[model samples]
Target: MTQHLTIVDHPLVQHKLTIMRDKTTSTAGFRRLLREISLLLAYEVTRELEMTTTTIETPMQTMEAPTLEGKKLALISILRAGNGLMDGILEMIPGARVGFVGMYRDPETLQPVQYYCKVPNELDARMTIVVDPMLATGNSSVAAIDLLKKQGARNLRFLCLLATPEGVARMLEAHPDVPIVTAALDAGLDDHGYILPGLGDAGDRMFGTK
Candidate 1:
């Protein structure tokens, strides 16, 4: 992956995002919308995956079939909120290898602190995609990607529902080679490190937490 940022401007993605931003939307509704939007985002994120052809015997005759090249894709969820996006993408690419990087912000410092991590072997051989709902400070996202790279992940991409300018800049500065795919890039972040006009705390909204 190269330094890139793709904003998913599809009507369906935007519509669902609008609903998710509504404060009145129920937890169930928010979760449902997230799943639907993620599938749309997944479509764009994997659009350039390499393909190879192989001969296959069809019902009518023999033909060459185009299939994905390289190792099975590795999907890394940044934990908690990331699970929402991960589940949807998994529905579309069920064959992908799954992993998790558990991290949380230190309320005082707003820095990411790793709590857990589990990933597949041979990360250097697969296309790894990291999923998260919001990219506010980008500290956690960057930290997650750093960890993945340490584990040998090379071709990596970052996917999220919303992002702020600060977060995007931070990611670019830290890992320019990793591409970013988001549904919307909001105006900026609030004082509390939340994306302005964002759908509040993604985890709280999706899980009905206060």
Candidate 2:
């Protein structure tokens, strides 16, 4: 991903996102749309994956077949809301290795506090994608990538459902090499770090929790 930030603009993605943003949408519905949209976003994110051709025997003839250069990819979800995006991405890419960073925003300071982190081994050799539903303050995303770099993750990308300009700029300043792929870049965030005109709390909307 050469660009710092890539926003998926497919019609299906926009349609599902519009429905997901509705206040009347139920928990089940919201979760379903998120998952469905994830599949599309996953496609866009992986579009630039390195590919190689291999010789393959077709019934009566041999031909060159295109295949992904690497067999495994590392997907690190920034929990707990990141799990929502990760689930559907997993469906599309069942062979991907999974990891999690358990962190939460401090209401007062809006900073990320890490509680747990377990990522795949040999991250430097694989393309690592960090998944999170919202890029509100960007503190958590930046912190998570910082941890991954310390753990030897060199190749990295960020996948999110929604983002704000402040968040994108922060990520660029913190980790310019890691490209960002999101469904939409919404208006600025509110006073409490919530996205404006955003679909409420992603974790809360997906899980029916406060």
What TM-score goes with each of the models? 0.97, 0.97
Q: Which stretches of candidate 1 lie over 4 Å from their true place?
A: 1-3
Candidate 2 matches the true fold with a TM-score of: 0.97
| Model 1, CA-based lDDT | 0.93
> Per model, how many backbone clashes are there?
0, 0
- Candidate 2's residue-wise lDDT over 136-209, tens digit each? 98999999999999999998999999999999999999999989999999998999999988899999999999
- Candidate 1 lDDT by residue in tens digits, 1-210: 224789999999998999899999999999999999999999988987889999999999999999999999999999899999999999999999999999999878889999999999999999999999999999999999999999999999999999988999999999999999999999998778989988899999999998
Q: After superposition, which runs of candidate 2 have C-alpha atoms over 4 Å from their true positions?
A: none
